[model samples]
Target: MDSHNTLSARAVPMDTSNVQIPIITVWVVMTALAAVTVCLRFYTRHSVIHILGVEDWLILIAMVFSAGACVGSIRQTFFGLGRHIWTLSPEIMVQNGIEQFYNFLFHTMSLSFTKLSIIFLYLRIMSHGVQRIATYVLLSIVMACNVWVLIYQFIQCIPLKALWDPSVPGTCFPLAANIAAAVLHIVTDFIIFLFPIPTLLTLRIPKKQKIGLVLVFSLSFFVCLISIIRMVVLKNLDLTDVTYSLAASSYWSAVEINLAVICACLTTLKPLLARLFPKLLGTSMASGESSRPNPLPRKLQLEAPSSRGRPSRRECWRLVQVCVLPPRVR
Candidate 1:
C-alpha cells in the first residue's frame, strides 16, 4: 500500500502539467503583497508612531530573507522545477538542487526571524510576570530550534557538494530528518499562535477593542494552516519524480513564508489602519490622544507607587493606558 501510494502520487495529473507559471505567479504576487505591507509597517513605525522597536528591525531582516526565498523559487522554475526529474538534463537537475538548497536556507531564516519578531512584540506588551517569562522561554526554544536547523542544513550531507552533485562519494541523512524539522516548525507555529491569548484576555480594554486586537494577532492562524498543508504535501512527496512531485510543496512553502511575513507586518500596521479607518480600529484622528500613536516609554513601565502606599491616579491611568491601548495607540 505504501509503494502504491508513492507511485500514484508521481502519476497524478498535476505532475505531468507544467506548473512553472502558476508557481511563479504565486511567489511574485505574495512577494509583492509582503513587500507593500512591510513598507507600510515601517512607515507606521517611523512616521506615525515615531518609534521603532527591535521587532521592527527583526521583521525587516525576515523580509529580506523572504525576498531571497522568492528569488530562489523563481530561479528554480527556470531550472525545470515543475517538470519530471527524468526529463531534466543532469546539469539542470544540479542547478535546481542548488537553488533548492538556498531556498531552504532562506525560508528557514525568514520563518525564524518572523517568529522572533512576534515574540518580541509580545515582550513589549507584557508586563514583567509569569507571562513575560513564558514568552522568553518560547523565544529561547525557537532560537535553539532554528540554530539546529541551520547547522543541519549545511552539514546534513557529507562533503557539502554531495547535496547537489549526486556523483560525489558522500552520504546524506535520510528524508526523515527533513520530516522531523517540518513537524517541529508546525509545533512552534501552534505555540506562537496560542502564546498571547491569555495576556490579551486579561487586558482591561473595552470588549470591542479587545476583540479587534485578538483578531489582529489571530491572523497568523491562517499561516499556521498553510504550514500544516505544506507539511502534508511534503510528507507524501515521491522522490522518483521529485521535480514534479515537489512542485506543490514548493508552492505552498512560498505561500507559507510570505503569508507569515504579511501577517507579522499587519499586526504593526494598526497605526496606519487606524489613521485611515478610524471608526474600525477605534481611533479618532480628531482627538489628540488617539492621533499620537506612540508606545509608553521604558521609564513609564518601571514607575513605582507613590509614598501613599499605592500608585497615584495619574500613574494608574498611565498603566491602564499601557494595558488597554495598543502599542501604536499608547
Candidate 2:
C-alpha cells in the first residue's frame, strides 16, 4: 500500500510549481529602467534645456501609468498568478483577476499617453504641410481609440464586480473583444512607427542629422515587435491554467510599455547627450537643440570671397554663424 501511494503521488503534478519569480523579476527590472529614462528626460528638458513642452509632461504621465502597471503585475503574483489555477482558492483567483483587470487598464493608458507624447513631439518639428495634416489626423484617431478602449474596458462586464467574481449574475464580452483590441493596438503601433519617416525624408537637413533621427525613431519599432509577441503569446494562452499560462504574456506586456516609455524619452535626450559628450552627436547638435522648425535662408551669400569685397571675412563669418548653422540641431 505504501509503495502504491508513493507511486501515485509521483505521478501527480507538483502543486508548488509556479512562474512567480520570473514574472516579478521582469516587471521590477523594466520598471527600474523606465524610471531612470524618465528622470533623465526630465533633467534634460527642465534642467539642461529649460524648456518643458507638452510632450514632456505627457511622457511623465505615461511613466506613472507604466509604474502602476508594474506594481499591479507584481501584486498579481502574490494573488496566485503564475500558478496552476486549480491549486488556488476561489478568493485568490478572484483577487488575481481583479489585479489582471487593472493591470490591463494601466497598460492601455500608458501606451496611449506615450503615443500622444510622440505625436506632440512630431508636431513641434513639422511645418505646415501634408505631414502636419496627417499627424493631426493620427492624433485624432489615437485620442478616439483611447477613449473607446478605456470605456469598453471598464464596461466589458455589466456590474463591474462580476468580472472577478464570476458567481455574480452579469454578462461579459467574449474573448473576441480582447482579440479586436489587440489587433487595433498592433495596427496603431505600426502606424506610429512609420509616421515620421516621410516627414524626416522631406526635411532639408544634413545627411548626418537625418541618419541620427532615423536611428532614434527606429527604436520604437522594438515596442511594436514586443506588442506583436505579446499578442502571439496570448493567442495560445490556456485559460484552464490562466495563472500559469498568462505569465509569458504579462512579461512581454511589461517590456512593451516600459520600452515605449524609454523610446519616448530617448528622442528628447539628444541635448543632454550633446552636453555630456560634446562631439558625440556632431556639430549639428553643438547648440544642444534637436529639432529645427526653421530652415537656413537660401539667399545667404557663401560664394563671394573676402578679396572680391562682396563681404568682408568677418561679416561673412557672422552671416554663416547666424544663417547657415542650425538654430536647432534638426
Candidate 3:
C-alpha cells in the first residue's frame, strides 16, 4: 500500500510549455508549399504541355502520402508529442504510439514514390545505354530498401499490440536498423544528385542554358545536406527525453520531404513560367528558331540511327533538345 501511494505521487505531469506550436507551424507551412508546387506541376503537365507521363502520376501518389504524413504529425502534436514521456497520460501515450506507426508508414511511402518519380523522369529523358542501366539499378535498390523498411517498421514489435500498449509482451529491432536505413536514404540522394551532371555537361545547348540546368539539378544536393543533418540529429537522439529530442528531427523530416516534392515539381514548371513571363525565361514566341514547337512524339526516337548513316551534329542537338525541353503546343 505504501509503494502504490509512492508511485501515484510520482505521476505528476512534467512542464510541457511551447512544445506543440513549432510542430504545428512546420507541418502547416511545409504541407502548404508542397500542395501549391504539386498543383502547379499538374497544371503545367496537363494543361500546358499536354504530355502527362508516369513521373507525373508517381509524384501525385507521393503527394498523397506526404499529406498523410502531415496529418500524422498534426495528430502527434495533439497527443503531447513534445512533452516528456512521463508527462503524458495513458491515453495520450497510446495515441502517440499509434500516430508514430502511421507517421513512419506515410514517410516511407512518400519518400519511395518521390524517388521513383524522379527515376522515371530520368528514364524518360535519358537514352538507352549505361546511364539507363544505372538508373534501373538505382530504382531496384530504392524499391527494395523502402519496401523492407516499411515491413520492418510494422513487425519491429512482435505481438503488434505492444506497439501502442506497452503492457503487452513484445520485442523490437535494434535502433541501428533506423540508422542504417537513414544512411541508405542519404546515399541514394547523393547518387541521384550526381547522376545528371555528366549528361548535362555534354548537352549542345547554349552555355547559359547548360549552367541553368546544372544549377536546377544541383538543388538535390541541398536535399542531401538536409538528410545528413537529419542523420546527425538522429545520432544524438536521447531516448530518455524522446519527445524533446524528436522535435528537431521531426522538423527536419518535414522540411526534407516537402523540399523533395517542391524540387520535383520545379523541373516541370519551366514551360508554364515561360508562357506566363516570357521575358523572364528569355523566350519569345515570335522568334522562329528560339520558339520552335517541340518535335512530335512519333519523331522523337530515343536511340540514334543505325550505323548505316551517321547523324550530323545539328541532328544530335535536335534529339537532345527534344529530350530536355517541355513539349510545346504546335
Candidate 4:
C-alpha cells in the first residue's frame, strides 16, 4: 500500500525539474526592461525638466532615485539570483535569504521612484486647479502604502535566519502576513491607475486623443491586474511542498518584476511619445470631432477664430454653410 501511494503520488519533482532556467529567463527579460526604462527616463529628463520649471527639482530627485533603484536591481539580478535562488546547499541559504531581502527592497524602491516621477510629469502636464492637488494627495498615499508594505516585509520575521531556516530556534508569523501584503499591493496598483482617468477625460483634446491617453493609463492598470493575479498565486504557496512552493514563487516573482518594468517603461515614455507622434495623435483626434457637416468657413476654423468677446467667425460661417449650402453639395 505504501509503494502504491508513492507511485500514485508521483508527479513533477520541483527541485530536479528544469524550472530554474526559465525563471532565469524572466530575470534577463526584466534586466533588458530596466535598461529601456532608464533610457526613457533620460529621454524625458531634458525637455520635461525644463518644461516643468519650478517643479523640475522634483523630477530630478525622482530620476536619481529611480536610476539608483533600477541600476541596483539590474545588477542584483545579473549577479545575485544565480547564487541566491539556484543553490542547493543549506549553508548558502542564509546568505541567499539576505540577498533576497535586498533584491525585493531595491526592486520595490525602483518601482516607487519611477512611479512618482511619472505622476509628477503628468501633474506638470495637466498643471491647473483641482487635478494638480489631487495628484499630490494620491501620490502621498501610494508612497506611504508602499513604504509600509516594505516595512512589513522586512520585519515579518525576527532573527532573520528564520526567514530561510524556519526549523531553527526562531519563531515567525504564519503565511497570512505575506498574503495580506500581496493583496495590499494589488489594491495600491489599481489606485495608481484610477487616479488619472477622470481628469484626463476632462482635457480639451479630441475624444480620440483622450482615449489614447486613457489607454496608456489603462495599460498601467492592466499591469496592476497582473500584479493582483500574481499576489493570488503567492497566497496559494504552501511550505508543505517546499520544492513546489519555491518553484511557484519563482515564476510569480518574475511576473511581478516584468510587470514592474512594463509599468515603469510606459509611464516614463508618455510625454516623449506625445511629442514625437503628435501628428498621428492629432489626426486621430480630429477624426472624432464631427462627421456631421459644420456651418462655417472650414479653412478659417482650421486656422483661427475668437478668443472670447468676438463671435467665433468660424461658428457663424459654419451656421451659414449649414443653412445655405445645398444638401447635395454639403
Tell me the deviation in Å of residue 35 in model 4: 2.0
TM-score of each: 0.83, 0.84, 0.83, 0.67
Against the true structure, whose lDDT is highest?
2
Q: Model 1: residues >4 Å from true position, as ranges?
A: 1-17, 283-330
User: Tens-digit lDDT track for model 4 on 200-290?
Assistant: 7775545654676677678777667667676676677554444335444555555555555555455445445544654442232134454
Model 2: weakest 10-residue lDDT segment is: 321-330
Q: Pairs clashing in candidate 3?
A: none
lDDT of candidate model 4 versus the reference: 0.54
lDDT of 2 by residue, 115-208 (tens): 9999898776665577679999999998988888889898999999998998999999987787778878888888998998887766555677
Looking at model 1, residue 203 earns an lDDT score of 68
Output the number of the TM-score-best candidate.
2
lDDT of model 4 at position 148: 86
Give all candidates' CA lDDT scores.
0.79, 0.80, 0.76, 0.54
Residue 261 CA displacement from its true place in model 2, Å: 0.7
Residue pairs with backbone overlap in model 4? 295-317, 295-318, 295-319, 296-317, 296-318
Task: Give residue 212's lDDT in candidate 1 (0 to 100).
Answer: 74
lDDT score, candidate 4, position 244: 34
Q: Residue 143 in model 3: shift from native, Å?
A: 1.3
